[model samples]
Structure formats: structure tokens, C-alpha cells
Target chain A: MAQITFEDLSLSFRVRKGGKIGWKDFIVQGLRGKGQDDDWLTVNPLRNINLSITRGERVGILGNNGAGKSTMLKVLAGIYPPTVGKRTIEGTISSLFDLSLGFEYDATGWENIRYRGFLQGETPKSIEAKIDDIAEFTELGEFLDMPLRYYSAGMVVRLGFAIATSAMPEIFIVDEVLSAGDAAFQEKAKKRMNKMMDTASLVVLVSHDMSLLGEFCTRVLWMDKGRIKEDGPAKKVIAQYLEESRQQQAA
Target chain B: MTKAIAATSDYFTQIWQMRYFWLSLVIKDLRTRYRGSVIGMGWSLLHPIAMTAVFCLVYTTLFDVSLIEYAPFVLSGMTLWGFFMTVTHEASQTFLISQAYLRQNPAPLAIYPLRTTLCGSFHFLLAMLVLFVYTWVVQGFGNLTAFGYLLSSLVLLFVIGWSMACCCGILNVLFQDTQHLLQVFMQMMFYCSPVFYYPEMVEKRGMGWLVDINPFAACMELIRAPVLRSEAPEIQSVLFAGGFALVLLCTATCLLARYQRRLIFHL
Candidate 1:
């Protein structure tokens, strides 16, 4: 069974005044003797977040810009280690934040599928089994043999979506990826995602589309300023969040 | 890779499971390296061969050494030196170049260096073939009996390359300036090592201990002495190079285990 827990998780980043200062900056700082720990500011992206997610749960994270929706998903994806808390995630995790991360532009579409599979932590044997299915779903025909550089935006999106969704991940984290692809393909992609959500052990999705979240998520987390403002049934939280944000905007 | 990493055994298992990831990365490295070129991957073979030829012609004439004698010497020296140079030079970029994979996939921290080493080793093995063909044509098949020694040298060179890659990959990830500093160090190392000339010349000048003290020098002779002249490498040289790499590997492992998860912050 899939399980995820966060115990007071917090993530902080150090920003420099003049931008990413390297060794030269440190040397200059030493020579000038003007350094007093004054140029560094700690930015907290996630603040004291605590939650537990078990198998058969579909949760939607709704938040404004910089409210830590992506940060929380990244934490679960093992991209960022928490600064002052503990996290335990049990099961296979497949993150879909930036689907084209490991794609090579110069490589042919077919070669990229293998490369992408490797980056996704799938063995070659398994990826081989899924190649025909991905090829058919992408519908790229001759383009699959051609370099990805020649592919159009919609074509790339279809490829990315097909490759990412082909595997049955025990824990799936989706962040703004479903927003891509053409209309016809987007509908097809949504159907595939909904099917996966029906059977997947745990799913966490971050999106701004209210209807999509309401249609898919059983629970909702409303975040404001890096903290959860509301957590309850999907419809109730979405209703309250929508009314509060509407009133705030009107004011 | 999400398994408990406290035990030594788990480390091996995690790395083993991730072998396909590293192998595919190496293949891609070789593929994209010469994608839009006429000569293509032939450059790998042409590179060290041209360097060895030019260096041999210039240096042997300047030193008044016989072409027949110095050819084997330069061939063996540069072949091993090429491995060392390519690895140490490219090691810094191993992590920086693969930042995408590192961010997306949390496999073993060792994968970066190991992949770079495998890529370099493929080139290194190709250049070794150049040496063997040249030797067979000019020097005859007599010294081919020492082929066993060449195998040992290849193993030792790989260990040294892996160590440098590990040692440099971490530092480069933390400090972007480390790559520039490493470029300078590798240039200095190239000149100081016995790649272009004979160690006997250094010894004749009463700087004999320089070869003994310089790990690069010892590593050069590990291949040069055995494959070129068919003599056993100094036991001390093998021990010194092995011990040095072992120390670096231990340090790299410790630092990687401690800071592996934190590396994303710096990148």
C-alpha cells in the first residue's frame, strides 16, 4: 500500500543580494572586510506543513502564487529535502511536474522515449514493453523516427503525456502538466488521468481548474501564504475558498 | 534508492538496480557528443593518435632521439594520459550537465561519476586499440606477451579516473568555480607528468624522485613500463596509485552520503 506523511515539514532557501555569489564573491567580501552576514535572506517556501496521505486517496492542492503548492509536491517527489522536519514516503513515486525535463532535443522521438524512460527510473525492459503503446497514443507516426527538434508543441505534449502516464505509479504527483497539449488530445489525456486516478493508490494533483479538481479529488487543501487555510471534503473546501477569494478580490 | 542506506550492502544493491540508468546515460553521452559532424565518432580515434604523432615528431627531433624508439614511448604514455586528462577535465560537468536527471530522479549519488567514467573509458579503450595497432606494425608482436600488464594498467587507470571524477564532481556541484580551477590544475598536471617525455631524462637531472612522488608520473609508468617495454611496473607505483584512489573514493563516498540530498539546494 502507498503511504506518505509529513511532520511539520519546512523548506527554506538562502538568497544572496547580488545573486548566486560564488567563491570570487566570498574572496572579495573577505578582502573588503565589509561582510557581516547582511546579504543573505532565508526564504521559506513551505511552513510547518503536516499531513498524512494513505492508499486510495486523491487530494488536490489549491493555492495562489508562491503559496507552496509546487513546493509541497516537490518535497514529496524527493526533489527538496525539508529543512527542519521529517518525511516518510512508502511506494514507487513518479513525478510529472516538468514532463520534458530529461528529453533530448537532438535525439529522435523514439530514442527520447528510451532516454525519458531511463530518467523516470524505468528499466529498459519495461520501457520496451510500453513503446508501442506510447507510439500509438502519441500518433506521431513518422515523427517518432525524426528528431524531437522537428516536433511541434502539440506533438511534444502528446509524447510527454503518453510517456509519463504509461507507467502505473503507486504515488503520482501532477503539477500543472495537464494544462498543456491541444484540445482534442487534452480531452484524451484527461480521460487517461481519470482512469489512473480511479485505480492508483495515492494521487496528489495541483491545479487551478476548480471543476477538474472537484471532479477528481476526494479531499482538498486550501493553502495561503505557505500554510493550509482549509482542509476537508473537496466540494466544501472549494466552495469556501472560492467565496473568500472572490470577496477579497472585490474588496 | 529510497531504501535504508545505513548498511554497506544496500549501497551496492541500489547502485546495481540503477545500472540501466547509468548505462543509458553513457550511451546518450556518446551519441550526442558528435551528432552533426562528418567525421563523427572517428574523432575519438583521431584525437590521441594525432596528438601522439605530432608530439612524437616534434619532441624526438628536438631531443635528437630516434623515431623508431620514441614512437612506442610516446604512444603508451599519451594513451594513459589521455584517460586521466579526459576524466579529470570532464568530471566537473558530470553533475552540472545532468542536473535534469538529478532533480527528476533520486538514484545513487555515485551515478554521475560512474557514468562519466564509463563514457571516458569507452574513449580510453578505443585509444588503447590505436596503441596496439601501432605497436604491432612498428615494434612487432614480441611485446604483446605483456598484454596482461596492459589489462592491469587499464583497471588501475579506471580506478584513478573514477576517484578523480567522484572527488571533483561533488566540489564542482557546490562551487561553480571549481571547474575553472580544475582546468588549470589539469594543464599543470599534463606538463608535469611523463606524457610527452621520458622519466629517465628527469632522473638524469637528479630529479629521479619526482617520478616516484608524482602519482600521475607513477600512473604513467604503470602503463608505459609494462606495455611499451614489457617490464613489470614498480610494485610501489601500483600500491601508491591504488592507495591514493582508495582514499579519494572513501572520502567521496562519505561526503556524497552526507550531502547527497542537499545537493539540489546548491544546484
Candidate 2:
């Protein structure tokens, strides 16, 4: 059975026109201005994105900025409901879309880890037992006791990644978080990701790192202008995406 | 329809999971607010005490209301008023202040303001501790009758705080200027609420109609009456606040569920 399915999902955002119109019409104009001749318009952020991933498939989404990679990931993670389609998801989902989202900067790293762990439904006893392991993974050392506000950006990323990856979720969605850390932390995160991949029923990663995608993903989805430009085996599809990017740049 | 049901269940489960995160956030918020101060958490009590002193001098010395009642009356009403204003003002800014947390993680948006409200409530708890000490020293700790009302008022304040937190939480997200607007509004509300002055004074001055409309005025009376006059809050006013809270909770849930995805985009 497919672990996740997104069927013809589409989302459009209104691009408001400038200047005012009629008082009554202005409010009624929905997305933008009313009868001032500028009217209104909408732009599709995600358009007809249909996909189905079976259990244990490591799929990487590749696109330039504004290509809807993040939006699609959010859709799959159930953060955004599609305007025009359906999503069928199975199993528990845990996503690390934005690295520093759940952490309290005033708290010690240890406290943040426990907090994030609990937010992902880990028991206090379980989180307590795993705190040492989580700290060791991040290599934050004694600084873990200090408030996260005092830590550097790289340290925040490392701690965030460590806490997020603590739980072995059934469906794991990683969105551009791996790009933040130092090389050593990156390698550690990569190892952790690989370990997760072995057990994760569905693993979806959205990133611009085509080379990394080539190295890790079994399949690649190339998105362009909110549409799937290509989907196939990782190397072949990514090559087409690169060619398309080059041609578009030349044009 | 089925998806909505599933999502509703998921929402509750998410809140359950995020409970610890919210608790930690409250602790962090409280610690950071008073971190570098020499007195630390004592500032919570000091703020109310200082405000009461200033108001006492102005209202009692300048005006005659303070003369009618001495320290106990002033302290009792001021304590409750301080709690109400502090909680409302803090909770109103909760969403705007915690933008970092709300944007970065998938934690429920409701939790951010909830943390602020909880932290504010916790501070109020600390202040109540100080209030008891002061009252004990002055009045000899003989008011067993008032404890029930005090407890009941505390519970009402909490319920009201949580309710306002949820409403103001979403409003702050939707309207960026809500925090600033609320600050000014709360300042205006303080004067109109009969906090330093008695409700009877407002009634005598032919502004009883104002008290009828002012929710915070009723809330303060609810708290003060129990503590000072040993009377329960008006059942009607309590019901009104409870109903208003229910409405706010429903509205917050709807806004949170609907626009929660777009909150990042707006930010």
C-alpha cells in the first residue's frame, strides 16, 4: 500500500492589485482591490501535484526557489490542505521543515531536546533516558547546559536536528534542514538519516542539493513552476532537471 | 467530513504531545523576563506593589477614595487589578512575541499564547503569595471565609486568561498591529475599569452603565469582592465571561486550523 498519496493537489495565493476601489466592492473583491480597474489576480503556488509513494521509498524533491518544493512537503505533512485535490496519508508523521521552530532559545539545549521529544509524543522517562544520547549526538558538550540563545547558529541547527531525529517516525519529512550544519555535524546527520531510512516507511526530502539527492534518494521528483517536470530514477531525472535549468538560464 | 474528523482528533493529539513543550516555554519565558535583575522573580510582586503605592498616593491623597479605605482595601483591589492587566497585556502579545517558535516548529499555535497566559498566571500565583504575607501581617491571617472567594476568583481569572490568550493569540497573528493597539487599549481600560476606584464610586458618578459594558471591570470586581467583601462574583457576570471565553476558544480553533498554514507566509 502506498504510504502517502497526493492527488491533483493545487493551491493558489492571491496577488493583490494596487490602489483602492468602491467601498462595498473593495471588501467583496476577495483577494485584491475592487472596481478601480486594477481588479485582482491569483497565482498558483502548487498546481496539480499528484504523487504516490509506497513504504520505504526515499524520494527527493528538487526545484529552484518558488518551484513549490516546500509547499508540497507541507501538503504531505498535512500542514496545508490542498485547494483542489485530496491527500491520503497513512501512519504517524514527523516533519523537520524549519529547524528552529519548536526550541526555546532561553532554555538549555538539554531542556529543548526534552521538550521537542515530548512534542513528538515521547514519554518523559523515555526522553530522560535518551537525553544523554541526544546530547552526545549533537556534540554540544557542556554548552548544552547554557541557554540556546548563547549558542551559535550552527549549534542551534545541530541541536534542532538532533532533537527532531530522535524519534523514529513512520513517515519522515526533511525540508532543507541538512544544509545548515558544519561538515562534521552534517556527516553525523547524514548517518542518522541513513539509519532512519532503513526503518522509515516513507522518507521525503526537499532540497536543492542535486548531488546529495543523487547520492541518497532512490527516486527524484523535479518540480518546475509548481508542476512536476519529471519523475524517475534519481540520476536520470536529476540530469534532465539540470539540463532544463541550463536551457532556461540560457534563454 | 471524515478528513475533518481525523484532523480534529489529530489536533487534540498534537496538543497533548506538545504539552511539555508549552510547559518548558512558560518556564523559559518567566526566567528570561527577570533574568538579569538583582531581585529576579521578586520583580513580579514588586511591580504590583509599586503600582499600588503610586496609585494609592495619587488616588487616596489626591482623591478621597484612597482615604475611605486604608492599605487593606487598596492592596486587595490593586492586587487583583494588577493580575488582570498583567495577564491580558502579556497574553495579547504572546503570539507576536513568540513568532520564532510559531514559525519554526509544527507545534500548535495555541500553545504560544497558552505559555504566556500560564506564565502570567504563575506570576500571579507568586504575587498572591506575597499578597497573603502582607495581608497576614496587617490583618492577622483570620480570613478563612475569604479564602473560598479568593480561590474561586483565582480560578475565574485563570479561565479568563486562557480565553483571552486564545483570542488575542490569533488576532496578533492576523493583525500585526494588535499588540500595540492592545497595549494602548489596556491602558485606557485601566482607568475606565474602576481598579483604583471602587465600583460604587463609578455607580455614584452615574457611570454605572460603563461598568455594565466593561468586562475587565466585572472581572476585577469578581476578584476583589471575594477577597475584600467576602461575596461571590455575580453568577450572571461569571456566565457572561464563560460564554465569551467559549466563543473565543471556538474562534481561535477555527482561525488556527484554517490559517495556521498561512501564518508563516504572513510572517
Which candidate's DockQ is highest? 1
Tens-digit per-residue lDDT, A53-121, candidate 2: 988888999989999898888778766657798889998777777755767777888888887787677
Clashing pairs in 2: A56-A201, A101-B104, A101-B105
Q: Please report how far candidate 2 places residue B106 from its true position, in Å.
A: 3.8
Query: lDDT per residue, candidate 2, B1-267, as tens digits?
Result: 899889888877877777877776677777778989999988887867787787777877666653434455666656666666655666767766777565445567767767877877777777667666665665565555668867876776776777677777666655555666778888898778776777777799899988878877767666656555556778766776666666666776787787666765545
Give the Cα lDDT of each candidate: 0.81, 0.74
Model-by-model DockQ, in order:
0.59, 0.36
lDDT of 1 by residue, A21-121 (tens): 55677678888887537998878988898999998888999978789998888899988889989999998887777655667787889988887777776
Index of the highest-TM-score prediction: 1
Report model 1's chain A TM-score.
Answer: 0.91
